[model samples]
Target: MSQPQQSTVRNRLLKALTPSDFALLQPHLELVATELRQPLIKPNEPVKQLYFPEVGFSSITTQGSGGKVEIGIIGREGLVGVIPLLLGSDRTPHDHFVQGPGEMLAISSQAFCGAVNESASLHKLLLRFTQVQYVQTAQTAFVNASYQIEVRLARWLLMCHDRLDGDELRLTHEFLSMMLGTQRTSATLAVQALEGHRFIKAQRGRVTILDREALENLADDGYGLPEAEYARLIEGA
Candidate 1:
């Protein structure tokens, strides 16, 4: 099969910009492909460019005395690295890594700041996206604390499938375990359970959702809705 097209026709945020406003920043927005399992930004590193994902998703993961856990994820639904731009944050609080392969429009920190400063519309749009992202971060915390492992696993798979626009996903059990903050054996068992239900099919490293509705039902109440809310807020903003 031929390679998927890795160019942006109109990213959600970019499309929201007035034609003239988009024109001002278009030259600075460089298109790049995200490699599987690659770290876009590391912990404690300086924030460089702002990435607006045109496809796939990136995980903002935090690590400490306990272990690593994904705090937030961004796809075409939102942009990455907005905290530094909004708060003047210099040190990275988490690692930013691509969870799946996709296209992104990247702009230098200087250029991004300039774009936000020059266009009031752009500023408002980005800030609204920021608010939605904050909600997601909060919900993820709740899920981590209160939800069962199977529920969380189902939620994560639904999320990955949503952003990729396909059921088939390229990810490893090790990676899934890290994202969910679960033991490898537990994660393996969760995958097995989903497979048995015919909600998903798992191989060595990848997973393909078989019945999306059943998977959504299995996620209980901690998933799906938050992502839908993010989309609505962005659309109405």
Candidate 2:
């Protein structure tokens, strides 16, 4: 079947596509609006689609008897469906949810597997992406274990800022509580503390960075690694 003319969507990865690569998968690339708080994959559910986020953040979470905690966040630097691609697994042990709103390039799992099998460039890219995910998982564990809540929040905001390419973030404290595996009261307190230090300005659902340099100083050492890795992986792509 003939592929459609390449899409001109705003997704960084989609836009970076070479003409030949874009044409080869143009018919399969469906542009979809990713909604915040939407569940991309249920825990322990079948992996049916691979999402290439163009402008949003998706959180990979592991749930316990208490609640869910975010283990990693993926944006334009990586793909969302790594289970099927790397382990040949059909199901996801973790839940995938959208943390921010933006456009995504979503393709079916079968199509993704086919593309990987057919294209050496794609296979290599996916493998490198798998490595990035590993790094994020490790860093998240380090952050949760060794860092204070305020520092962790700074790191989180910095990571989000790096992806969003802006200083302002639209989010609610309630959702952030879930992401951080903390109580809502705790989250509120953290936000207030950050605000007091002029690291962020929080009003209603929006939080704007006031002094990133100070935040970076407070973010601890592990925080900068992911930001640097993102720069190396996706800058100018």
Candidate 3:
């Protein structure tokens, strides 16, 4: 790839690569558009491609008889399919799906695994990202367990805002329910509470952030720890 082409890569994991490491994987990288709610990796299915999102976010979710709840969010800052690749397994326990519309750079899992095996730095960086993702998942569990519905909703909104380019998020109540592992009525009530506080505005299928500071305040400690860890581990790469 040309210098300018490499320079234009937006995924943080790709951007963190040393020139030599990047060169090793460059030929295999394919930029592709992704649609909202598209499944990048399905549960128990072999991961054919590892995705590094450039412009949107993907949700790592676990499902049950009840439904699915998001455990982690992956965006420009992280890569999907790391667990399966690291484990030398082709399938993952969780499902990964695009939560918003955007583009990503994808590499076939076999190619990515080959590059990782050959590059110590790349291996270490990806391992560090896995750690960061673990923190995010653990924090999500903490937030869901300890926080109020409104507070959890605020924290979730902040997460989406961090990943997306703008304040407006095109999300439905049904989707919010799925992400939060709550009933739609409960999600609607939480949305109303945030709207009442002027922290956000919710329409039929979208929510617009009006006051991020207030939303953060509402979320309190539920939102910052994992984010700080990600910055500490990934941003420095």
Candidate 4:
């Protein structure tokens, strides 16, 4: 298997690692492809591999009384399977899976934990992401509770847009319902609302951004805090 160097990796988390810390992990990191809906962390199952996606993203979801609710999004800007480990657990109650197909640099949890235990700097750097998740989840909860379906949809789209490279998002109404924790009909109506405003143009299974700034305004305070927190903690690292 080919090992990827931290300097050449697009994952912001890997890129943020110091050279010494990177060296500790360089030997173990292998390039791998993650397929859509492929399970990474099954609820209550041990998280054996950690992934730093170079492209695409994954959804960290949990069971809610209503059904599955997406709590966080992990992409090139973040790492997967780190939360349970950072919190001193081998497993988590959340389901983590690929939302889209992409290549990622993956390492075994054993090697990942060993490197973190060996380097205080590495451990500290990775831990900042844990804080970023906390903020993101809290923001998600607040937005879900306080905002209208249109507003909530806008917030969700904005988050997805942040982790992607292009303006078009490959998403369906049912998929969006799960992400927003709303009914499918609600999601469709919201999509129409955004399209009505020319904020986005919704196609069969794709949505293209027409005016990102307007969507941001519609999302308003529902967005930006967690992103700012990520910038302050992870990017600044």
Candidate 5:
């Protein structure tokens, strides 16, 4: 397999690595295509590898008798499997699956753990990223409990748009309901509301952003904090 270009890698966590730190990981990184809905980590199962996306995003979700709800998203901005690494464990507490189709740089958990153990910079960077993920999860809980479905939907769309390469998002109402932890009807109604406002156009298996600024305005405080935190922490690295 071809080695990843240290400076050109798209994953924010990897890109934030110092030259020496990245070099320790570069030889072990393997570029691989990720399929939509592919499960990368299962709850209570050993996390065998880490995935740093180059194009798409993954959903980190919690499962219970009430079913599953997405708590956070990881894209080129972060890596999957860090939670296990951070806790010094081999298993995850939640399920992680690809939400968008793209490519990722895959590294075996053994290699990643070894690198983290050897590099203080890598250890610190990963810990900071874990904080960003915590912020996202907490914000999502607050949004779900306090905001209207339309506002929540707008926030979700804006998040996906941030990670995606284009304005169009290939998502279905059923999937949106699952992500929002709502019924399909609620998701449809929220989509209709956004469409009526011309903020987004919903179609078969896709939603296209028409006015990102308006959507941002609708999302208000729900969408920007965690993103800003990511920038603040990652850019300073």
Candidate 6:
């Protein structure tokens, strides 16, 4: 893989870094392809590559009595495999995998740690991003606990829309059900509800956002807080 041009980099965290901070990790950053459903990191396994996604999104999930469910979405906004590293660990219990197909700027765990240790500013920036994750996960918990299936689906869709390049999301009902921690029938019904409201048009394998504002209004407290936190902490920092 080749090194990515700084100006052409699309990852929000990478784009937000100062020249000096970016320079510290530039030599080790390798642009790599990410395929749909590819496992980026596995539970309790040593994390080898840290990916800063440029185009696609990743699902951060865990499994238990409730079954496997996603907790956070890492897209162009953040990096994976660093949360454990930042906390002085080599791995995590959470599962990380590509949900969308695209490219990621990847680095080895060792090199990433070296860079983080070498620059106080870089470390600060990454810690800020970590905080963003905390906010997102917390919001996910709140939304899932407080909202109905349709509202939760709307919130998840809005988050996916924020990460991808277009309004059309290439997610099937089964996949959406897995992410939302609901049954396929429930997810299908939610899709019908959203389509009925003209907020989205759902097909067999794709969903197109037709009225984003309506979805936002419908999902009022289900989303936005964490996104606002991201903008305030990382985008502006």
lDDT of each: 0.80, 0.78, 0.89, 0.89, 0.91, 0.90
lDDT of 5 at 53: 93
lDDT of 4 by residue, 47-101 (tens): 9999888988889999988899898888888889998998899999999999867
Q: Write the per-residue lDDT of candidate 2 for residues 95-192, one digit (tens) a residue.
A: 89888788778888888777767777666555656766778889999988998788888888888886785788988898788778788888899999
Which lDDT tens digits does candidate 6 get at residues 146-194?
Answer: 9999999889989998988889988888888889999889999999999
Better of 2 and 5 by lDDT: 5
- Top model by lDDT, which number? 5
Q: Which candidate gets the maximum TM-score versus the true structure? A: 5
Each model's TM-score?
0.91, 0.88, 0.96, 0.96, 0.97, 0.97
lDDT of 3 by residue, 102-211 (tens): 99888899899999999999898888888888888899999999998999999999999998998999999999999998999999999999999889998899999999
- lDDT for predicted candidate 1 compared with the true structure: 0.80
Q: Which ten residues in a row have the lowest lDDT in candidate 2?
A: 1-10
- Candidate 3: minimum summed lDDT over ten consecutive residues — where? 1-10
* Candidate 2 ranges beyond 4 A from true positions: 1-19, 233-237
Worst 10 residues of 1 by lDDT: 1-10
Clashing pairs in 3: none
Candidate 5 whole-model C-alpha lDDT, 0 to 1 = 0.91
- lDDT tens string, model 5, 183-206? 889999999999999999989999
